[model samples]
Structures are given as structure tokens and as C-alpha cells.
Target: MIAVLIILVSCCCFIFSTWYTMYKNRNLPPGPTPLPLIGNLLNIERGALVNSLMTLWKQFGPVYTLYFGSKPVIVICGYEAFKEALVDQNDAFGARGETPALDPFAKSRRIIFTNGERWKLMRTFTFKTLKDFGFGKKSFEGKIQEETRCVMEELRRSQGQPMNPARCFSYAFVNVLCSVIFGERFEYSDKRFSKLIGIVDDIFHTMCSIWGQEKNDPSSPFTSENLLYVLHSLFMGASDTVSTTLRHALLIFLKYPDAEDKVREEIDRVIGRDRLPRMDDRLNMPYTQAVMHEVQRFSDIAPLNGPHMVTKDVQFRGYFIPKGTNIYPLLCTVHRDPTQFATPYKFNPNHFLDEKGQFKRNDAWMPFSAGKRMCPGEYMARMEFFIALTTILQNFTLSSEKEFTEDEVAPKLAGFLNFPIQYELSFIPR
Candidate 1:
């Protein structure tokens, strides 16, 4: 009898606490009412995180709050809200938010998850080091070209037989990253490398290197532990994000053979069969450029984007967001904003093409995201997208045994990382 009374009192206290907290945050941007313990967990449909958030965007308007447990997360959707928060008020919204799953392990140590002076110092060091090692410049072109050749050779060995290119794409992307950070590239067959890749894949389902050898200053952020975390950030970006994007690009081309043909035609005209596609050739190949941009927009990988935090309390879009409040700057909403794109849902390269058939920039198309938290590796990723896809098209035509529907080729829209459907493709030599 005493135990039952205690349990009843405990339940009452919990309900009161939850309601009081909600009442306190009443001035925050409004959304659906959250339950006591779970907050709005029931509001989200299982296996459709991006869709769920987007649906809320329509119902609650652009800037609104969604509770994850008792905590209020300010979700900024659409291109306008994104620009206003992430760009116009970047500093206030610049702090890294808690990635609950990663926080215990990462401990806000990595470049991607850290905030304040640590992030600034890490970014400066990494950018300079990677630049010195020729990441974003023409000097690095040879490394990418060589890695693409390795991929081409591997595909040729497939002998036009259908195979899942995911593993091959993973190897190529990791090798390019490994080469720069570790000063060595692993063969696709290397057992250790294969194991490492496998571990990375598993973690994405849930959630590199030695450049700091010369730093002697103990006060500097370039400690061995910090360097490892930096490498962790770089590896995670390359292994999953870049490789998944490549998979999406190939799958999209398979779905639209006509689009693939046009890219090939451009490749033949400027890049030709004699050599691997050069970054210089991108200027002359507008169609290819448009297609690459379209693929990114359509894929919408990292849709929710890495969570951010408000550094200080501020008014945005007529709502008050408190300091350290979690923020979800939805990249998915921006890429698919109807106001921004003519046909946002469909995979149309014309979203990036002008009347003159030249590639045009759309600020809404921010796969690397925008503002202070934008990807430091943007230049390298862009180079990979262009050079890798061009090289593949230059060497072979992509085809699939299974005819994928538009939905099949579309972004999975389920998890943190958007993945293309698992399908096999035959790379017929051109």
C-alpha cells in the first residue's frame, strides 16, 4: 500500500514538472504539444525523420520548436529562415548542439562537434594543413585522378558483370582521404582497411591522421588526442558522406539514361576519351555541372544537417530562442523549397541551368550547408564529385538490371545520412 502511494506521487510530480517546463518555454516558437517524458517522440513517424520534420514545417510555419524529451529544439526550415538564422545571425546560432549519441564518445572534441575558440583553432589548423597538402588546389588533382583510375581499373575487372558498387565507391573515397591524412593509401583488398570501412558503415546506421607531427607547442590545440579527433571528423565526412553521394549520383544516372548520355556527350566533347576529366573541363561542360548539382539537391544527404546551438538568446522570425537551445537547420527543406526551385521535388538539372543552358548557382542548394558551420572540406568534395563522376562516365555507361522507380532512386529520407537504394549496376565500357 505504501509503495503504490509513492508510485502515484512520483507520476504526479513528473507530469507537473513536464507541464511547468512547457509553460516556461511558451514564448518559444510553437509546435505540437509534447507529452511528459517522451516530448514529441510520438509525433514523429518511425523511419521517416526528414519527412516528419518537413511535415511539421508545413503545419507550424518556418521557425518553430519541437521538443526532444523536455528540451526545446528550434527547427529552422525553408531557404528564407535558413538564410536568416544560419547566415544573417550566424554567430548567435553558431554553437554546436548536443549530438546525444555521439557526445559520450566524441565529447565535443572533434572539429564538427566542438564550439568556441577550440573549433576556430581546429578549423584554421586543418584548413591550412590540408591546403599545404594540396587538398583543394590543382596540385591535389593528380591524387584524385589516380584514385579514380584505381576505381576505373576495378570496374573494368568486373567485366561488365552487375555488382554493387557501394563497396568499390567506399574504397575509392576512403583511399583519397587516407592518402592525404595518413600519407598512405590502402589497397581495396587490404584486410585492415576493409575492417575499418566496415566499422564506419555500422556507425552511420546508429549515428585520420598524422599531420600534427611537427607541432611542439603544448599550448596549441594540436595535441595527439585532438589530432585523432580531427582525423575522425575528416574520415567520417569522406567515408560516408562522399561515398554515399557517389552512390546516389551513379544510381540517378542509371534511372535516367538520357541524362547520363548528355553528361557523356559533354565529357566526350571537352574531356575526351584520351584523358581523365580535369577540373578545367567543368567550365565547358555545363550539363555535367548541372547534373552534379541536381544529384546533391535531390539526394539531400545530411538533410537535418549537423545540429547547431544558439550561442545566446535572440529573436528570429519573431520568436525568442534561448541561449544553448538546440537548433535543427533543415537542409532538406531548403533544397526542396518550392519558392526556391521550379520543381523542387523532381530531379531536374534545369534548377541549376539558365535559358542559355549554362550552370547557374542557387543559394538554396546548400548540401555542404551555409555560414560559419559550412563544411571546411567543401572544395575537396566538389572536386571529387566532378572528377570522379566524369571519370566514370568517360570510361563506361551505367546500367541496372533492376529498373528503379523515381521513389527508389530518391533519398531514403529515414536516417541521419540519406542513402540511395541498394542496387547492382553494370558499367559497360564506352
Candidate 2:
């Protein structure tokens, strides 16, 4: 009898809390019913987070809300609506939101998570520093060129054997980024480098973004904690993304040898085999530029962009969004939007090239996101992708060791980043 009474009381409390939570945010955008604690998490299909979100767009229209626990998360779909929230109406929607899954991981102190004046200060400092550190400049390209040679040398050691290129790519990109962050690069065999990587993984699961520093700046927010998280993000940002894109680019080239041949031809024609590819060479080689853009487009990394929140309570297209509502601009939908690309589902390089064979601009091709809150590392990452890819094609022709069906390379999206499944290839010397 006592046990039954306890169960009944617990049920009543759960009911009341769920009701009170729903009543408070009644004006927020609508979507599926959220459970008492888990919210719409269970509703998301397993291993298909990106696809499931896209499917929900069909039912919910351009914008709607889902829940993470009791917190309301607004999902924005399509190019125009996604751009409006991220690009145009950025003041209200630009702030980063802390979800239960990501909040515990991101310390709410780093540039990727913090908001308002804090974000502004860190962003300004970081961007200025990155620019000063040679981002988008020829000097940065020189570093990438040096790393490209190192990776090519590693590939040459493979001697035409079927090799999984992920490690080689990771080693090269990580060192390049580490040099940018720490003023030097580490050899693959360095024990200290391995330990530093372990630190990055440890920080990822914990939100303790602090390491107390005795000195202070009233106007500055660069705490040791902030610096650590920044370092963590640099390593995290550097570790997988650029490497994955390069991997995907190689995979696509393997799948489409004709396209690979075109890139090699462009490299040979514009820069010659004797010289390394330069960022300036991109202007003269439209097809190579098209290939690079298409790889990003096709890879569709970060399908749901980093979670953003409203900085303040605002009126948005017939909805009243309370301050602190989590927002996800569906980038996968943007990349695959029929309106944005001619053959959105197919791997076509012409999406970035005009009939005159010039590299045409597309505002919708936003892999790094946009607006005041746009990724500070955008230019650096793009430059790395361009220089690394072109140089690789310049030195080697990638061929699949084992034939794969179209569906084989189509790996399911995991977390935020998406790319082809791991496969082996021969880096045949050109």
C-alpha cells in the first residue's frame, strides 16, 4: 500500500511539471509532443539524425520547434529561412545555444558557445589573431604547401599499395593546424603530440572550461580556460574536418576518374608538375575550383550547424520565440535544396561553374555558415582544402583498390559531420 502511494505521488508530480512547462512556452513554434524529460530525442530515428530532421521539415514546414528535455529547439529548414535566421536576422538568432548533449561538452566560455559581448570580444580577438597569423594570405598558403609535400612524401612511401588515407591526411592537417596554434609542428612519432591529442579528447566530454590564471584583464575575456577551449576547438576543428573533406575529395575522385583526370589536367596546365599549386592558381583553374566546391557540397559536413540561440525575445515570422530557444539551421537541406543546385542529389561539378567555364559564386554554398557569427576559421579551412587537394592531385592519381557501389560510399551521417565510409585506395604516382 505504501509503495503504491509513492508511485502515485511520483506520477502526479511528473504530470504537473510537464503541464507547467508546456503552459509557460505555449507561444513558441509547434512540433511533436515532448516527453517529460527526454523531449523529442527518442523521436529522432537512430543513426539518421540529419535525414530524420529533413523528413520532419516536410511535416513541420520551414520552421518549427522540437524539444531537448523541456528546452524548446527551433529547427529551420530551406535556404531562405535558414539564411534569414543565420545571415540577415543574425542579431536575434546568432547566439549559440547550449543543449543538454552539447552544453555539457562545450564549456559555455569558448567562442563556439558563449554569447553577446563575450562572443564579440573573443571573435574579434581570434579573427584578428588568425588574420595576423597568415590566414588567407600567401604566407598561410606556404605552410599548407609545405604540409602538402610532407603528405605526398608519406603517400610515396606507400608505394602503390592500397592504403586507408585517413591517417596520413589527419597527420598532415593536424600538424599544420598545430603549427598555426602552437608556433611549431610535431612529428607523427612524438609522445608529447600524442599526449596533447589525448587532452583534446578529454576536454571534449567535460565542460570544465577553466584553468585559473593569476593575472587578469578587465577588458579581455581570454582566460586560461578560454584559451584551453580555444586550443581544444582548434585541435577539434582541425583534427577531423579538413581531413574528412580531403578524404571525401579523394573518394569522389576514385569514384569518378574522369573528374580526377580533369583536376590533374587543370593542375598541370595552370601550375605545371615542377611547381606546387598556389592559391592564386585557383582563379585560372575553374574546373579545379568547381571540384573543390563540389566536394564540400557533396560531403555536406555539419548537416545541422552548431546550435544557435536567440539573444533576445523576438517576433519571427508569426512566431514568438523566447530568448534562449535553441536553433538548428539545416545545412544538409540547404546543400541538397533543388533550388540551390541543378543536380542537388548527383555529384556534378558544374554547380560551381558557369557555361563560360568561370567559377561562379553561389551564396547558398555555405559549408562554414555565415553572418556576424560565421566561423572565424572559414578562410583558413578553405585555403587548406584548396591547397591540400590541388597539390595531392598534382602529385598522385587516386584509384579505388576495391570497386564500390554508389551506396557503399554513402555512409550514414554521424553526429554533425558527414563523409564517405573509410575505404582503401592506391595513390598511383602521376
Best by TM-score: 1
Deviation in Å, model 1, residue 353 alpha carbon:
0.6
| Candidate 2 colliding pairs | none
Alpha-carbon deviation at 381 in model 2, angstroms: 1.0
Q: Could you tell me which residue pairs clash in candidate 1? A: 208-231
Candidate 1, 325-368: lDDT as tens digits: 99999999999899999999889999989999999988898999
**lDDT by residue for model 2 (315-392), tens:** 887898888777888888888888889888778899998989888888889888777767777777888888888888
Cα displacement (angstroms), candidate 1, residue 201, comes to 3.0
C-alpha local distance difference test of each model: 0.86, 0.79
Off by more than 4 A, model 1: 1-10, 107-109, 208-220
In model 1, how many backbone clashes occur? 1
Query: RMSDs, each prediction?
Result: 2.5, 3.3
Judged by lDDT against the true structure, how good is candidate 2? 0.79
